[model samples]
Target: MTTSPLRRNTLKLSLLTLILMGFVLSGCSGEGESWNGKDISGLMPGLEFELTDGQGRPVTADQFDGKIKLLYFGFTSCPDVCPTTLQKLGQATESLPTEAQDDVLTLFISVDPERDSPERLAAYVDFFGNGIVGLTGKESQLRQLAKRYRTTFGYEEPDENGNYAVSHSSAVYVFDREGKARLLIRPDLGVEEIRQDLIALAKADT
Candidate 1:
């Protein structure tokens, strides 16, 4: 029996889709429980930063030097990505053993410093129900850090209602215990996958 034209087209499309998926999976999938994120261990985009914490204290990246860190650039008012990623980071780390959990820290650096004051950052960070350390600083300092990390963020003009929006990078940067940037995790990765990767990175040098 001859197949219909529609069925032939469908088969072709499905084959093409599978080919594309194979390429993506091969390029993106790290070793399941080993380096499950994109390995940038030797890359220099996320070297360091000098910023303030949620409580308005002067803090620098080196201050978190000895611990593994997860860094993301966003604002308290971010409509979705920032908060969700923070929660994922929180949940993933919490899945670790107590001692392993202690080895990891997540930094939510505010790209909208003008609106994300220390007080606002504290409330926003706390609302996520985890131990993320909120941070913000002068635009100049943040801008420099963004440049170094290749993270981009900017504010749109305010609307008639005096509201605005920001466009920023959504990559989760993982730094090892030695302060060397290691993995660039995609925000859309699965929670379990991230949990496993976080554990692997945290214990890599320990």
Candidate 2:
């Protein structure tokens, strides 16, 4: 069979289009699988702040640079999630290898700064672990930090008895040594799972 010059050109163009489409589709597939059985990445993690730690000294996110940082956002008064999550984190941190543990930093950032004063946050975190750092600041500062991290938090009105609650994201963010968000662990994650992931992250090169 004889093929015309126009038919040959048309075939070449069609093959080129198919090849380009395959490349695009393959890239998308790989991105989709990057988070498979792992935490989501892409969100940036650190924000500049002059928050006060449990010791009443100034602290900034920069202090955690060049280490694996685990940041948890919650209030001291949280009836359930905050305490439980911190405890889990304590357990996880305890399980890390010495090298990994030395390279990890844990932070508790309170969304309810109105009531979660530095003293309150410090005591709360200390109950879970000695090395866990608690961060609290002016409401505006806390809100700005949360916004930078795309974390959501709000206060629920108190009932007739004047008791209130806070609704906040329960995901613990994992930041790589370079301060880039690398993964998220849900509140319900087991201590062992969190420990394993943190170890893997600490060992991962930037």
Candidate 3:
């Protein structure tokens, strides 16, 4: 009658996703100014993290100040969701006015550091677009960032072929230029909705 590590992690991740999804639903109920994405103005803290970039150099959230950020968590090995989400974000940023496009940035943080090396992350992100940056770090740093955003991730046991699956929140966290949390971009949102939300956030108080 003992729970395995995989089961424990999965349960914790599922619970965390439910809790954060509730916040997203409430934020999207139009409690304040309307936004295409869920308004998460005060649900989480401003962006802050100490991690390694795709180049294997250290980075902090403060280094990205003054640009609107779309922070997402996933792994490069992910067969579907990660690539799709990154592509959607890339498209959303590209749809912005040429001038406004540069104002938005997508930070793709990979939680599966065991397999996602800095070089692999760099190449993976490059396939997306210039507006996106790849990031990862030690498990401890990753956990801190995930915890800060009220999300969690877990890994499934590997099969005989040495392949595994990862469970992670598919939501993207949007922050304004000043690094204040602003919106939760749910996976169900389309490119246009995400684009519009990015435009508003990028142009805010500028």
TM-score against truth, every candidate? 0.81, 0.77, 0.91
Q: Candidate 2: deviation at residue 156, Å?
A: 1.9
Ranking by lDDT: 3, 1, 2
Between candidates 1 and 3, name the one with more favorable lDDT: 3
lDDT of each: 0.76, 0.71, 0.88
Runs in model 1 deviating more than 4 A are 1-33
Candidate 1 global TM-score: 0.81
Rank the candidate models, highest TM-score first.
Answer: 3, 1, 2
**Candidate 1 global lDDT:** 0.76
Give the per-residue lDDT digits (tens) of candidate 2, residues 15-121: 54355334334444354323312344553545356788987888877887887778888888888978888888888888887766777777888877777777777
Better of 1 and 2 by lDDT: 1
Give the distance in Å from residue 105's predicted Cα in candidate 3 to where it truly belongs.
Answer: 0.5
lDDT, candidate 3, residue 62?
Answer: 94
Among these predictions, the greatest lDDT belongs to 3
Question: lDDT per residue, candidate 3, 162-206, as tens digits?
Answer: 888887888899888889998888889999999888877766648
lDDT of 1 at 146: 73
